[model samples]
Target: MTGGREGRVAVTMPQLGETVAEGTVLRWLKQVGEAVADQEPLLEISTDKVDAEVPSPAAGVLAEIVVGEDETVDVGTVLAHVAPGAPSPGQRAEATGAPPVEPAAEERSPSPPSGERSSPPAGGPRHRHSPRVRRLAHDSGVDLASLTGTGPAGRVTPDDVERAARHAAPEPVPSPEAPVSVPTRAAPQRVSTAAATEPLPSLARSSAPAANRAFRTLVAEVDVPAAQWVGSSDQASVPVPGSAAAAVVAAVAGALRSHPSLLAPGAGADAGDLAVSWSTGSGTTSCLLSQAGELNVGGVAQRLLAGATAGEPPPGAGFTVSLLQDTDVLFEVAEPPPGQVATIVFGTPTRRVVVVDADGSPGIAIRQRSSVALSHDPGTVSREAALAFLRDVVRRAHSRA
Candidate 1:
């Protein structure tokens, strides 16, 4: 945009990835003196990982054009500027205070849905999210239906986007569990699969006059939290070693695929989105939690598991849904159980663990920024039997609640 004194606008093509070199300038969102609002759609960009739209920083005349359309520019390139008083920068340093640039929707990237890669690890068992969050997802075309968290104690994080992309880039050959490379022609047109990137949906300071720095999120109840189940020294207390945890993860993933909206608060709002992850700490094992600024656990998870069934595949696009975290504490989003309340329990060859929740609680026994932990306990009261009883209680409570 024009940099003259008459206009105080500052526009730039913000970067989406730490490693992305260049992106195609597919189109522009605004024109000269467009009377734009802060964070208004200013342009669109199509990169190797995403085809996204950018928002304007302020409301003002688009006085000048530093770069014409169709020019492929490096990150931090000066494209245009909005005049002063038009907009203010957000506290979020990540946002460039500009709109999306470059073309969009031309080609889909091999990125993980929403990038759960940066979330939690998936090498162990899976956890649960909300079901209500799933139902609302269908209406938005966004998927809360399938994110894997990797935060402390298996919580999800915004950075999971990067991890998700990396997971989506390559598929492992099943037989030997090895990375497989296919010839370009045999595979769908693929871009860099291993690089990390982000979707910067930053709003201009001027756009949100009422919501300057902080906003409130939604609240939810766990109703009946998770618990374990068993009968008669039961169905093989543990699966084949690592298989039990895998099954737990698979079950949780099934829930996410059935539900979608657990990822966000409402249509188009970003902050309230839920995050799930897992980790291993010094004392015990745990799942970390970091809620969306405005959302509660039940509200998000309830919507996420509305239509899902046990065998159906989870949603794997637009949002990150995978075991993509680097540390043990992180995990991808698992499935949300149906009903107002849900339950979970784990039994190993030698240990039994059960977690409980009430209607008002999200069922998380412990909560923290870094983790909500559980451990491999071998010495508890009637560990195995207690585990089974708790699971049944949670399931019934959820159904009745």
Candidate 2:
């Protein structure tokens, strides 16, 4: 936060992450002259990694907006200004350098006499409507003042305008020469009790066919001891149980940063500014990290834990990592959701006998290992690229271990 002219305080674009240098203003939750509470969501912003709501730094009236919606600015740039105290309407107008607005006709000192014509109410719906909503109403030929507002504080929302426009749309008249046919109703089919009793397949299961058509899966084995060591070591930033998961996440993040080709076309332009979805027992959460490629195992763990705890997932993640620990399943091909490019599934680690190279010869030894599988969209990512990425993830994980 910075200081503004007069007694107003400046709200600048915050540095969201280590690698993020800029952000785009998405929307203003509070317009100029509106009183906002401290920590209240003031606006929405979009960066390469994630979209988030920025909160007000102090309780005050929003004095001015220096940055408009959709404008991109560098970090630390002043975005707006907020006056220190709750000002009256006239004071707000003066602080914003705008002329004081007159009261609505209904609230005027003297009402229009003898049916004399009076101007429309100053506080009509248009006054409270956002620029976007007003534009939409104008384009859709909807009357703003007549519609009942369903939004907060009786504000006319875009949806309400759209709904009114749809309802007011003129019906087409049929020509006399055109033949009209009566529509016949079809009989409803009866469902058998057994069929109805059968459990419905989950959304992922039902979409498997379509997702499989464009996706490819690759599986690899990782040394579980290395991951466990990183997880339990003092260097680990997250809890012991989640340390391994963090290691995997860090590896994936590094791989994505190193090989942008692994991501869908437009998704890679941001380079290291990437966000990944993490699926755990609680739910899937989108985690955004700063300089993920340079972050140590602990740093990755901390970010993942924070995101999971927040519960509210940010949008625009093309890659996902799912943890399926504590299960016997060696590896499972997890399908990516719509708009997602790929998913990595980690299986439970288990002790297994494997050939170990000792001094000068190979010998049988017991070791902990886990199966990891990568499910990616073949249409966007080639098999070779996917395999290379998977290999890179394993290599990075081992490097940290």
Report the Cα RMSD per candidate. Answer: 24.5, 22.3
lDDT of 2: 0.60
Where does model 1 exceed 4 Å of error?
Answer: 1-7, 85-401
**lDDT accuracy of residue 239 in candidate 2:** 28
Q: For residues 1-401, what per-residue lDDT tens digits would candidate 2 score against the true structure?
A: 23367877789899888999999998787667666777777888999988888888887777789999999999999999888765566656766676535442234322123222222245432246789677556544557777877987567797787566445533232122222111122221111001011112221233234432334566776765444422223543332336666777778887776455455445642443445443334443445655666777788777665644323234455465655544445555566655666667666566767777899899998766666777665555545556667777888777754
lDDT of 2 at 224: 52
By TM-score, how accurate is candidate 1?
Answer: 0.23
lDDT (Cα atoms) of all candidates against the true structure: 0.32, 0.60
- Candidate 1, residue 148: the lDDT equals 59
lDDT winner among the candidates?
2
* Residue 228 shift from truth in candidate 2, angstroms: 6.0
